[model samples]
Target: MRLSAEHAHLIRAQALELAGAQARVRLYGSRLHDHLRGGDVDLLLELPSLPANPALLAAQLAGRVSRALHGRKVDVLIDAPGLKQLPIHQIARSQGVLL
Candidate 1:
């Protein structure tokens, strides 16, 4: 993966800072393939293991990261505990870089 440690740290830290320390973030998609070029950053964010409005929490987290990574198109997918599995989430979890 070409994702810099700084960016990864920022991604994870931003989730912790804006949301909570419990958020688990992963990076997936083209960014993961060194052979590929110029694609938006794809992120799968597992919401903090807490009780809250998952959708709103996801939007908040995505907004913070989007701002932090200015000029980059970021696609953030959120997963809540016990929620039904989505294929994207499965792919990300299996192959993505854990931020």
Candidate 2:
């Protein structure tokens, strides 16, 4: 996916803030394009371990990201080693481009 300067910057900043030093964040899908319809930002975040409160983290990240990006929708995908059983999880493991 090709990312514009603004979107790329926002994604990188948010990814780093949300993952800190442990996780890697990857942006995927149509939102990566320039003339796109503000589709939900597809993110794949790979973390070393799940947090104590996953829901809270998701909500907090969503809120912060939404506010940062204004009208754009943000979809965050938090990944971890534990999800190896799932097929889609392979994206998080292999295709992720660290933020």
Candidate 3:
């Protein structure tokens, strides 16, 4: 993963803070490849239960994480018990590095 230890910790911390301790975080996309440069952070947050407002939660998590990362672009995808699993979610889970 391209993220520094501090960044990874921040992301995991923020995700858990908003989504609960049971949530799982993964890092995906170009940043996963060390050879790649200047890619935005791609994160998949897997939740144990569905949130009342998934979209709002996603936005809040993304905004908080992005600010924590010094304004770096952060893309957050959410996976919950009842939410539809998109292809991107599959790709992320398959290729993502757990953080």
Candidate 4:
């Protein structure tokens, strides 16, 4: 579906807010394009500091965003520093667009 400007605005605002607490939140995939559809809100979230419960933090952030914006679909990917060695993930880490 064509995401309305209002929806985009809400996404941007929530993303910025989430990014403040995490390492970095990048908006990726078709949602970033001005004209695109049938794609989820792709988010590459990086957490610099390794908290006691990393998954918990990620889940909380995702839950807050999902709850705050009812009916909005989002897919959050949390990338912790010094973990995972996939090339695509690494590329996303280096070349991804930061929100």
**Best TM-score goes to which candidate?**
3
In order of appearance, the predictions have TM-scores of: 0.84, 0.70, 0.96, 0.63
Model 4 Cα lDDT, one tens digit per residue, 10-55: 6556655755554667666676566665665666777775556656
Runs in model 3 deviating more than 4 A are: none
Per-residue lDDT of 1-99 in model 3, one digit per residue for the tens?
Answer: 689999899999999999998999999999999988898999999998999999998899899988988899999999999999999999999999999
In candidate 4, which residue ranges exceed 4 Å CA deviation?
A: 1-22
Count of backbone collisions in candidate 4 = 0
Show the colliding residue pairs in model 2. none
4-99 per-residue lDDT for model 1 (tens digits): 888899889877775676778899999999889888888888774643666676677677777877867788777777766789889999999888
Count the clashes in each prediction: 0, 0, 0, 0
Please tell me which model should have the higher lDDT, number 2 or number 3: 3
Error in Å for residue 81 of model 4: 2.5
- Where model 2 places Cα greater than 4 Å from the true spot, the runs are 33-36, 83-85, 92-97
All candidates' lDDT scores?
Answer: 0.80, 0.66, 0.93, 0.63
What would the per-residue lDDT of candidate 2 be over residues 1-99, giving only the tens digit for each residue? Answer: 555667667766766676677656777666556677657766776678876665566666767777877856777666765543465567544654554
